[model samples]
Target: MVGDYDSYFADRARRGAETSPTSATTEPAKTAPAKPRNAPKSGLTYKETRELETLEKTIAETERKIADIETLFSDPEFYRTRAAEAAPLQKELESLKTGLDDAYARWGELEDKKSGS
Candidate 1:
């Protein structure tokens, strides 16, 4: 009764249907992405991979802060009269921008080395 998947069997047994054959068979085959013909011969070293991951995380966090600052800027009063709020937002925006610049520079350096440029 447990493996019986037919509607009639489920109804008769008052239990859920068994896993469908199609469900088990429906998973897409896993495949690696096609590499460019001129792609780098050497793969990323462990340190480079770790640094890229860390930089990506830092960039994402900085972007989120920028988005928060932008949202705060959307209010007219934020720009006109809310100097205190605007001050912090402006400072944060600058910091995040600097962070983005540094992250991009690091990424560019890593990519140039990887591609033998």
Candidate 2:
């Protein structure tokens, strides 16, 4: 699980670097041939970039909420005392899992498009 999360973040960092302006070093920055104003280095259109950002936000938030719920479920005392509450939380966890799956699928599609796969 940690590997999955780490890979996601590493991929995000790589994509972010691709989209950002080139950093200047001690030497003068060499200018590359200019691309069209609308063309980003990542090869995603502006709309697709926006969609990716939104999807990333949703995925991160959903993962966080799922982790919180999982932590709650892991506590035996909480479960023993609040078995009734567990059913609603279980439903919520399933719902969140579904949404996370969808978000990941969409993310993969966008990534594939970006990679020209």
TM-score of each: 0.54, 0.60
Please list all clashing residue pairs in model 1, or write none if there are none: none
Q: Looking at model 2, which ten-residue stretch has the lowest summed lDDT?
A: 19-28
Off by over 4 Å in 1: 1-43, 77-82
Listing every candidate in turn, what is its Cα RMSD in Å to the true structure after a full C-alpha superposition? 18.5, 26.3
lDDT score for residue 113 of model 1: 71
Tens digits of per-residue lDDT, candidate 2, 1-117, equal: 356888989988998897666553346768998876875466678899899999999999999999999999999999789989999999999999999999999999898888877
Backbone clashes, candidate 2 = 0
Write model 1 residue lDDT over 13-85, tens digit each, in one string: 5432354555677988889999779954675788997998898888888888889888879878777787677
